[model samples]
Target: MSLKRFLDRADESRRSLLVANRSSPDPILNVLEATFDDQPVRVSERAVPDVETDTVLLVEDGEVLATSPLSALRDTIVTVNSDLYRTGAMGIDDLDMPAVLERLDDVRFTLRGYPKSNTEKLLLVVVSRYIEGIAWQAGHGRHRASFQYLSRIKDERGTRRVYERLAETDVDVHVYGRPDWVPSERFDVTTHVGHDADFRDSWVVLFRPRPPTPDANAPDSPSTDHDPVALLAIETEPHVWEGFWTFDQSLVADLDAYVAREL
Candidate 1:
């Protein structure tokens, strides 16, 4: 469903105020501009003075370093910790506000935090991961039979279990990539040849395989090794989209143009 529908449903239940502590040019504000331009929700530039509202969207840093005081956030504290993108683990220590976490059940909380180095990257990662997580949750519950990935399907370092589980569950997989590379029994696949001809030039070259050296005992070829971390969605939902968009309207316009051309 679209973000407007989500907000419309939430409105039927309780009042919500989009409390944004930071000023303009913030990613959260971009979200408000994109989807809620017509909505009548209140926007605040200060800490929540009261907790009378049913839901609260406290968008700020996780503040794991205690850079700011927690006194302002006296109740129902909900924070997003995205440190896993850098480190291989969740920022559990960031949620160390004992008093706040004690009332975690009292807070209508959701943590869609996984690491991305920058905001632009984080936005795309969030959207992609959110849809995939929905599909995975369905698979676990035996709800939705399958979902399609509109990108290349490669046997990367960490996705073996994902493919295995989907195969075991008989989930219908559709992929838009090299048909020969992926078997038909595994995925309903399509090869997009000569589609977006410049796409290949934009890929970051990380490694290249080489033939064995003349001397059998020669050292292995030089290569780039990256962190083997995978992005995970820890309780993301559709409603969260209502609070995020590109930091600039130009980026949104570019996305619109691309979606018009490709989607």
Candidate 2:
């Protein structure tokens, strides 16, 4: 059945419940699935045939996942990030952070295009800033120095180089969300249980979580005309560049505070 029909059915039930893609494991879908899990919400799946037909809540994409719905349902929120409409608007390019860092010389590097994977590029920018910060402090005769990094997710190879470079410098490093595999002496570590925090002016990288696997016992949801995979790229952009971090007050504030107090 069409999504509109589903929503219409839901309206008749007079419930505040929401629906999500059941069969697709897209990040947004997963978020909704998790949010509504065990709650009295409905879901649409492509893997198994939906047994609930009559009075079924029909849902449309914009009605559930986009701005209009959220605005209508929630109170006003102060946002430091980009506007909702601007999300996923940036196109993918061919930039690579590791290569840029290799060529970096105290001078700035130019972007030829956005890379297919910009995670490394984002790391390069942050590490470069840390390097610059350390140099500035040393020149001013500051005996103590440190750079703090707050990462929402872990990246081994990309961050390894960052840790190594900082380790060689005069600056001490503190990493939030450090993984178990990372050595202790490499940098100081801290724990942050908050949902969000601030960082200094730097780059950012974004990622989409992999979808969950289908259950063998669950009903098979028929595939619709909508393509879930196509939306993944756009959803993962804000977390991958130097300029992007400027918009995140949490990251910028935290990094600035650490520098002021520690270094």
Candidate 3:
């Protein structure tokens, strides 16, 4: 099936954000709502006893899946901009996503960038970097990412640095894009070049960690228990995209398999 089909499949699942015990001002709630505007998520507020003030909860089908401090979310997510990533101002190590945001895995999202709006696309960028950071830390996973055009790898300082670092590690790095620019040998990543629709419209970052060996006993070794992570998006129109990020191992495996066998 196509990448768009995967996004369509993910749309069947839904989640909401509940801002419980919010003692914060209206502006704070407004920002929270604005962050999720036009996305699949519904953000609501209510007062619940025993819950800390300004705590944000991720709820699915009336069950609270995870929670995070509203202040922490505001500082980490709400206040950020796309330039911080484009200019390499924020390193991958600097992205400390809150649990609530991390819990957004499996949620489908539609976002617009640049001339359409400034903030809508920032969330996807953040998630992409977060996945990259995970692969970097794991050190031995397989990372496959797409850039629409190979030139972007060199044009975006942060992105170039990220690939450079990933290449230095044992991670099996693969990059897909249009063949507008060829990467130098120093990058050391397997290049998948194409001029097809998938290369032009898809945005995918997937990391599949190698399973731990039975005799492996290093306490500091990156935990093999970590789930495979993937972010898949397809540009539906100029500057607009629809997609989802997932931590589900089965789905991640399916996605990786598709990429390996097809794209």
lDDT of 3 at 83: 77
**How well is each residue in 48-111 modelled by candidate 1, as lDDT tens digits?**
4543332235332333211223322321121232233223232212223322222111112222
For model 3, the stretches where C-alpha displacement exceeds 4 angstroms are 216-223
Local distance difference test, each candidate: 0.28, 0.27, 0.86
**Candidate 2's TM-score:** 0.25
Maximum-TM-score candidate:
3
lDDT of 2 by residue, 94-185 (tens): 11112212222112222211343322233233333333333223322111211223342233343444344434554333443222334544
What would the TM-scores of all predictions be?
Answer: 0.32, 0.25, 0.92
Report the lDDT tens digits of candidate 3 across residue range 1-263: 56677886574667889998988788878877887887778899989889988899999988899999998777665777877887788778888887888888877888888888767788889989999999999889799999999999899999999899999999999999999988888879999998878888999999999887665565565548656999999999999988889988888998898888777
Instruction: Give the 10-residue window scoring lowest on summed lDDT in candidate 2.
Output: 226-235
- Candidates by TM-score, descending order: 3, 1, 2
lDDT sort, best first: 3, 1, 2
What is candidate 1's TM-score against the reference?
0.32
